[model samples]
Target: MPRRHVKLHARPPQEVQGEAVDVLVRRGLDDLRRELDVPPSFPPDVLAEAADVVRRGPSGSRVDATDVPFVTIDPEGSKDLDQAVHIGRLGDGFRVQYAIADVAAWVQAGGAIDDEARRRVETLYAPDGRTPLHPPSLSEGAASLLPDQVAPALLWTIDLDAAGAPVQVGVHRASVRSRSQLTYTGAQAAIDDGSAGETLQLLREVGLLRQAAERARGGITLPTPEQVVEQGADGVWTLGSRATLPVEEWNAQISLLTGMCAARLMLDGKVGILRTLPDADPRDVQRLRLSAHALGVPWPDGATPGDVIRDLDAANPRHAALLTDATSLLRGAAYVAFDGELPAFTMHAAIAAPYAHTTAPLRRLVDRFVGETCLALSAGTPVPDWVRDALPELPGLMSAGDKHAAELERGCLDLVEAALLTGREGQVFEGAIVDVRADRDEGVVQLRDPAVRGRIEGAGLPLGEDVRVRVVEASVPQRTVRFALADDQADSASA
Candidate 1:
């Protein structure tokens, strides 16, 4: 792993003219859909089932929890709400009432909807739109825990001590209502201005405690800034980076807390799926240390990789490059399933604990099954026959969906980069070499402006060093960008 130069700014509006990047994006989306074999729409049977369920409303026995004033926090404009929370301080601990959308209640086992969800595995997201795992009639309307709507849910009541360690856990089918739908930004604003209601204020306190506990467990949290593409009112697309927000992390802690509880239940019951990742390889860690040294970043003695990474500034290009290189240490993530015996490896290295996906069933397929398993175990009943039969096949199905999702995300980014740099060929820009082919004369370089990454054609390009390079080509149809070191600079370095 090596550090590469990356550009970090969006082009000014005056400079971006004539070309319709949105049209190019649409074309790219079509290309990706064809290449990836994305489904056009839900099967007729699945849609019909969804419509029927929507008309019928929630069925089966459920405990009424509509008295709890829970609120959902997600990104702005999100509709497929999955989870809601209400936190309160008890005598010496905290009580967390987390209500997750009970999607399985609406989708019967071996039914048309279930069959379609198995094939889809998970929702696929793109900048333009999303290919939802379940039909919108169910995922967005009926199953969603929208504000003021009573939805069937799997309610988890977790009691935690002052140190944020779980002292008790309970899960059951319940009908719940959310009092409000809050965005991450809105919740954060309330906390900062001291205008937050009792539940939100308690959320901040419990969230901080949980985060501190995670850090104490040696969990790794990468500070990678997200590269976002936004279309203006005038319909011009611009690319920029957004730092992770505090409220986002705090909200995620609640989800993580629930996931950990789910994992514990499955492990204790000796049956379920676990999200596992091997510990960072020693060799990869050594290489990352070398990379850090090359980038002039410090790795204090006796510091764990997570300790060092957690403190790096995301704004630093070198730190960003280091984080990109650290991807090697995070390989081999998988879903492990078992019925009668426990898996030898159970920990998710990033979390430094056993974890499972039992939340976000509205967006993810596995959560629905995991939630069912946890519910059955909590109720002291036998695991459902359908869930038990599907355990072994889940790993492969989820892996395929994960691959498709990663490719779609990367492909979209590549397409946007090509469209944005379409007419800027041959312009020299400052960049750093992030990676090099062992047996070739080319290496990957990241530019500083527009924050584009592409291959540079040059012999002996210094790894982890800043250099000037000219954009050799930008091809929108091929979705490719290539660069070459400036002639004088190459000659000088050779001299």
Candidate 2:
């Protein structure tokens, strides 16, 4: 029996590069667009109702947004402000505060807002625009953490020790006001120099401490460069790798702290969604070990999976990139909403603990449910039945949402990469081999460039990071890019 062709190998400049490739990749995205069922519009009434809720202060909870000096950091043109943060140095460590938008206040159970939110499940972002789960009036306006507006929020106050590990975590819901809205680029520039404002400086401190703690814990980190497609002067798509600022990762660390804390409480109580991934399979582990050996990366015999990944990441970046594929293989992320018994698997390989999504309620529905559960549990009240009942269905809904998100993103990426390379099909760009598998028919290759990442064809090659390849063929219709060995360069290929 013939094995399924997995990789589309790279080639020399002369064999495959020209106008023919662009036509192929374009057709592929079109097929994805039809298959994915991307939405065209949401009901108008839903948006209007969300706006009403945001404008009207919650009658059940007391909130005062002033005095915290909360500031929001997000991409340019972003309207849904899901979180706000402020940090300050305490006696020997730091006091970090993350204020997440209290979306529950507006989304009352069985209400129109709730119905619409549940129907959409999650926000869908496309190259053209986004289909927001909530109406713009809410997600972009009233519910948004705009500067000087007193909005309801679920605040987490985490006290970090000298090493940046959380010594204490406190959660509560209240009203808060934002000092300003900042962008990653602006904060990054400030951190690079001494000119950082008080807000930016505090953020940098928080980011640094959290990063140090992760490194100390032997957390596996990767440099997953992503392409940001921007429309040019004539409305043509252009692609560039989005810079991952220190502030971005630091912000994520803060969210991790919050989510980990939430997961701990839920697990202790013996119920709730435990975001988990099982340990990597030994087969893939052995393959990675072999790749590590080839790349001069030493794997300590008894090191934890996280530690092994960390060492590999430090030694060879391309091999580290490949580790990402295996990381997800531990287990698919599940919402395990059990009643009394805690499931056997409760560990999140990345965080080294049980974790769940409790942040970013504006964009993700699961977080909203988890946030409500945490709020109720913290207050020593019975977890509401509606939220609990919804738990059973959450896993399926979230899985569907995840699949849609992945397909939509890949579809958009297909368009952007094709458009960027349409004019220069044969042009060679630097890329690292992400994966290489040769079972029977054709050797497969997955390559990563600074601007884009995709699979190609090739085999019997050094599969590790930093191996350079020339872009041999780019087919817009097929949504594929082909690459081949160039100038005797060794490539790191991941499975």
Candidate 3:
């Protein structure tokens, strides 16, 4: 397997996340993976089939779209490319040509590769490495929408009016060649310095327009920075956060538009799975407002949670805490499959619209299926029997995969915290209470110096206030790092 290098997002960087740099940290990661039953490599048969599929190449008459000059944008050194884009003028509207990697071209359904992908469900990432959904030969090579590589793709032609509202959308299989692969910082620099081509300049225009449309629809987009651990030249590991550049968010708008478009197609057919999240419970939003009030964070009257959160800065400790805890509002996300009758609910609250996961097929299992559903529905053909039969179970597999991925992320973070705080037990640290559980004498804390977040055991824990606490326990072997209120301050905390 090719070495996996993935940047992972965690709690807005108010936590300790490990990227193995030393022998001890590396061994601890290995042990942690074993405890979680994470697969280290693909099966022999799966790899053999992947290589054979790549050798045979795409096996259909694909629409030649290489002249469109699409380009891919992702993190630096990224290989598992998934989506590419090119924007052009279309009278009073814009023509957005987005090409997503067509993984179905190489990964035969029910074959060894597909079966293995089903088990994996989605790509699992850590600060150190990742467990990819497909073998690298497909994910990073042939099926990846890499620059200068003519690969099969699901090309989407979405026409958007001047206001960024979609007027028409269509997707079909095609052969595409990305003209360039750009990193976020590089792309943003080009746009800022007036060195960008028409495609990139149009992306900025379309991205801003779409953002306004999202706000009008009461949507919230959380562009969380990734947590990273770097080893210095002297071999000392230090952890930090990678603040996302503007280009990343702009690039993401295109994906979001495509997802919303795909969902429209699936909903029209009424026979596909949707990535759904009902509107946030009103009680949850009220709770957030109360917390913000206690923390002295301003909440203007008539402003929604999305508005308040949009104005927050992660660099502020109080804002960081609020943002971390605010994730609760976006909970209860799950997949819903419908046949003839539409489900009772279908809105993805955060997006404020019907949405499906239709991009990143190389990394996510559901996207491939969603792509197929939209393709068949668009072509006015019968949905494949295999696809129809699998819809019922896809939700369960994806839900399980979501839970497992969360566990893996938390375990890795705990290991890093435990290792970083070795020999620091019984020491007091300054931190802030991010969340308070009314039913229990405990909440969540974000430490000051190391920026670690963990469970806190204390009474009268004020929400979003800085306080001093002692590290009651830090056990590397158990992969645990815990904190408790100091003896003198146990009952003294106030809102």
List per-candidate RMSD values in Å.
3.1, 6.6, 5.0
Model 3: clashing residue pairs? none
Clashes of 3: 0
lDDT of 2 by residue, 216-292 (tens): 66565654445565553444444555536667877788788888888977877666776776565778677766766
lDDT of candidate 2 at residue 130, scale 0 to 100: 84
Cα lDDT tens digits for candidate 1, 1-495? 111223344344434356466777778879888898889899888999899988987778999999999999988888999999999887799999999999988998899999998888889887778899999998888899999999999999999998878999999999999999999879889989999998888887888888788888888888776666666666666666666567778889999999999999999999999999999999999999998998898999988898888887655657767877888888999999999999999999989999999889988889998999999999999999999999999999999989988888888788888888887888888877777664889888877667778888878877767889988888877889999889877996577
What TM-score would each prediction reach against the true structure? 0.94, 0.83, 0.91
In lDDT terms, how accurate is model 1?
0.86
Stretches > 4 Å off in candidate 3:
1-21, 223-226, 229-235, 427-430, 485-495
**Can you tell me which runs of candidate 1 are displaced by over 4 Å?**
1-19, 430-432, 436-441, 459-467, 487-495
Residue runs of model 2 more than 4 Å from their true location after superposition: 1-34, 54-59, 197-199, 298-305, 311-331, 422-430, 440-452, 465-477, 483-495
lDDT of 1 at 367: 94
lDDT of 1 at 46: 90
By TM-score, how accurate is candidate 2? 0.83
How many clashing pairs in candidate 2?
38
lDDT of 3 by residue, 1-495 (tens): 011123323322222334333555667778988887889999999999998998999766789999989988898889999999999999988999999999888988889999998899999987677899999999999999999999999999999998989999898999999999988878989999999999899999998888888888999865444456554454454455556666767788899999999999989999898999978788989988987887778999999898888877665667766887788799899999998889999899999999999988999899999998888888899887878888999999999988889888877777777666666788898887777786888888877656567789877887767788899777767887779887667757643
Which has the greatest TM-score?
A: 1
Give the lDDT ranking, best first: 1, 3, 2
Local error of candidate 3 at residue 362 (angstroms): 0.2
Per-model tally of clashing residue pairs: 11, 38, 0
